[model samples]
Target: MFGKLYLIPVDLGHPSFEALFPTLNREITSTLTHFVVENQKSARRSLKLIFPEIKQGELSLLTLDKNTSELDLNPALDWLKSGKNVGVVSEAGVPSIADPGSLMVKLAHAQNIEVIPLIGPCSIFLALSASGLSGQSFVFHGYIPIDKAEKTRFIKEMEKATGRNQAQIFMETPYRNNQMLEDLLSVCKEDTLLCIACDLTLPNQYIKTQTIGKWKKLKTEDLHKRPCIFILGN
Candidate 1:
């Protein structure tokens, strides 16, 4: 029989894994000796936090980021075919949402390997839920355009979609977050609702939904270099 694949989710900038995850997640994590990870360093650090007594030398972590192709994941695929259960882990939050690891999942499917996903914090859904936007119809466009002119066009397009009562969810690199906020303020309508969810599930979490006009009146420099999610809605 072919082995199974487990999708493991780590913490979101929070050190307290016990608060965000169940005991069963810890138990399952402890059982696996192999993991397909976004970054070996980050994955190893997180595993140490979740399972303090875990032996680093005993585990095999295969790097599976955006640049990873099917050819790069042959060993992991072969491990599953050898009836060995493997885990897929990301740098933070859930695997393959906006991060990497999807290619490995597709390969596992082709080989008819059973994939089990453990529940954990997902920034997109968490941000939308707290944003008080129209969650019924929402879309996540991942990262926005880097060019200013193109970014303005993209923001307007996302804003226009909001007229249909749909929430537009998107994000940016932590270092570029401040600029994204500025671009949104300059483009969205005055009354259009904008939600900024930063440092989600962490003690200093910031989640506020305000009109574009109201946002302009507050200090938003705190978002600089912080993990954030932006949503636009009517």
Candidate 2:
């Protein structure tokens, strides 16, 4: 008997949850046994929302702490030892990219467990599709710097990458998003095209593509305080 590992990435809060719940339930019915959630609270909250009929014996929900890098993989290690199926989930988006689940994934792979990643929404792809940039060649720079000097350096690097016709994508925490935008507008050339994909796949989802010149005149106060993906091109 082979054990299983499901990598479930939750994009939006409700809709993504709704879409994944049914599929996850079917897996449970088929003998899935362990779930590795970002945290205990998130695990319980998601289970209650998706599968209220969760049983104590059929599943083991391991809640990893916020400092995921420091999290001990002993639980997951033990589960693999028992030949039990394990599922990995992130708070939002796919697990392992920007989440702590990658560590577990590496460990599981070393043990030769079956790792299957389920289909789900990813902001990076969504932004790339709508950005009108070079999809064939793009680099996800992940989160950018918060400090002024570091942020400037990062932007310069991104501009250089974009000059090579590669779509450069990065994200910033919501509260600092506007400031980041301001910095981009100030530094990027007027003709530099930028795409801001906000609240993707949600009711208030916004995808706008424009040059630095155009964004400078737009009123940013109106944008909702939700996380957004920023894409830029030459």
Candidate 3:
């Protein structure tokens, strides 16, 4: 029998994993010896936190990021075929959702390998749950375009989609968060509602929904360098 692939989720900047993840998640993650991760350092650090007694050298890790080649992932599948369960974890939040682990999961399905997703906090879902927007019909545009003209066009389109009762969600790099917010306020209508979920699941977390006009007047000092999720709604 082939071993299963476990989709593990990590905390989103929370001081302790216990705060966002259940004990069962930690238990399952600790038992796995093989893992495919986005960043080796963060992955190893997370594993050490979950299993304090784990020997760093004993754990096998495979890097899977935007640059990882399809051919390079074959080794992970080989491990699973050899009856060794492999875990997939991202830098934060759940794997394969707006992350690079989807390729591995897709391959697992093709090879008839069982893929099991363990429960944990996902920032996107967490933001949507508290946004008070149209949860039934929503779209998540991973990241906005970097070009000024393209970003403006994208924002306007999302606003139009939101007007039709569909929530439009997106994110940006932490350092560029302020720039994204500026473009949002400048391009979106004054009355359009926008939700900003920042530092999710962390000690200094902040989530608020307000009109673009209202947001324009407030100082966004806190969101300057924080990871955030932005949701646009009517």
Candidate 4:
């Protein structure tokens, strides 16, 4: 029988993995000798933080990022084929959700390897739940365009879509967060409700929902280079 593929979630810019990852997840992650990771260096740091007892020497990590080719995954697939359980660890939060690792999951399914997702914090879901937005019908646009005109057009469309009782959820590169907020404030209507969820699950965690007009009027937190989730709702 082919070994199972476990989807493991890690901390989101915080070392408090104890609060986010459950015991089952820690147990599974600790037992795994093979892993497909976005960044091996960061993954090792996260592993040390989450499970200090984990033997780093025993681990075999394969790089699986945007540039990783289908041919690059042959070794990992071979490991699974040899009845060795492999874990998929993301840079932060859950794997394959606005993050890398989807291709491996798709291949594992095709190869009939059981895919098991261990419970952990998902920033998007946590933000939406706290944002008081329409979670029943929401869309997550991974990252908005870099060009100003394109982003403005994107946010305008998302706001228009939000008019239909749907919430538009999206993120920006940490450093570009403040700039994106400025665009939202400039392009969106004054009455359009905006939710800025920043530094989720951290001591300085900030999650607030306010009108674009109100947001402009208030002195906001330092979102520059902070991991954030921006949601547009009714």
Best by lDDT: 4
* Greater-TM-score candidate between 2 and 3: 3
TM-score of each: 0.97, 0.87, 0.96, 0.97
lDDT (tens digit, per residue) of candidate 1 on 1-234: 888999988999898887777777889888889999999999999888778888999999889988888899999998999988999999998998998878899899998899998888899989999999998999999998999899999999999999999999999999989888888889888999999999999898999999999999987647988899999998
At residue 185, what lDDT does model 3 achieve? 88
* Candidate ordering by lDDT (highest first): 4, 1, 3, 2
User: What number of backbone clashes does candidate 3 have, counting pairs of residues 3 or more apart or in separate chains?
Assistant: 0
Give the per-residue lDDT of model 4 (tens digit) for 1-234.
799999988898778766888887777777888999999999999888778899999899999999999899999999999999999999998999989999999999999999999888889999999999898899999898898888889989999999998999999999988888989999999999999999898889999999999999999898998899999999
Clashes of each: 0, 0, 0, 0
Give the worst 10-residue stretch by lDDT in candidate 3: 11-20
**Residue-wise lDDT of candidate 2 within 88-115, one digit each (tens)?**
8777767776566887888778878888
Model 4 RMSD, rounded to 1 decimal: 1.0
Q: Residue 164: error of model 2 in Å?
A: 0.9
> Which of the predicted structures, 1 or 3, would earn the higher TM-score when compared with the native?
1
In angstroms, give how far residue 228 of model 1 lies from its true place: 0.5
Residue 203, model 1: Cα distance from true site in angstroms: 1.9
Clash pairs for candidate 2: none
Q: Which ten contiguous residues of candidate 4 have the minimum total lDDT?
A: 17-26
**Pairs in clash, predicted candidate 3:** none
